[model samples]
Target: DQQVKQNSPSLSVQEGRISILNCDYTNSMFDYFLWYKKYPAEGPTFLISISSIKDKNEDGRFTVFLNKSAKHLSLHIVPSQPGDSAVYFCAASALYISSGSARQLTFGSGTQLTVLP
Candidate 1:
């Protein structure tokens, strides 16, 4: 499905700089948003998340911003280090009541961020 899209397939940034990853979603029902970082031969790990009620959320050098009206979200990394280089995925989920359980996610293809020295 084209529910989530990351227009840029890759990104390059220098160490000690800022890196911005963009994502767009077509589904308005999505309320929970997340970002994941992954390395080669490894599964994606959760990085940060934001609920539709909030506009921004931050954790250390990583920050996620959600704009509900525009159906857009972005992840920002400040003073990015070489170790931050990895593929980043944007995910979205809508709460459902099926089987009294929820939390299935729709993920964007991914954006590869390369941090240079």
Candidate 2:
């Protein structure tokens, strides 16, 4: 069973517009959340991250919001650009006391975002 899920497999937006990507999780143990962007044939690059302690985190054009009660999170990108077109992945990590680390990361299948000019 997939703990993390991205309901939308693809999204399209016009350039200079806002793009909203959503994700949901069934795991309550998840404490750390991350959003990654990937281009074709390349590795996924870290975009932004938010800890469970904070409900929201913002970095430039990217913002991540976590709603613990709803077990949901969303990524917002303002003024989306053509270069921002890529596969976006939502990942979560839960700390393991035995390992004292967040080694296991659960990833969603990913949502392909296309920014049309």
What are the lDDT scores of the predictions, listed in order? 0.95, 0.96
lDDT of 2 at 8: 98
Relative to the unseen true structure, what is the C-alpha lDDT of residue 59 in candidate 1, on a scale of 0 to 100?
A: 98
Model 2: colliding residue pairs:
none
Model 1 residue 12 lDDT? Answer: 99
Name the runs in model 1 displaced over 4 angstroms: none
Indicate the residue-level lDDT of 48 in model 1: 98
Candidate 2 per-residue C-alpha lDDT over 1-113 given as tens digits, one digit per residue, 9 for 90 to 100:
78999999999999999999999999998999999999999998999999999999999999999999999999999989999999999999998887688458899999999
Query: What TM-score number comes out for model 1?
Result: 0.96
Q: Mind giving the per-residue lDDT tens digits that candidate 1 earns over 22-42? A: 999999888999999999999
- Backbone clash pairs in model 1 (N, Cα, C under 3 Å; residues 3+ apart or in different chains), count: 0
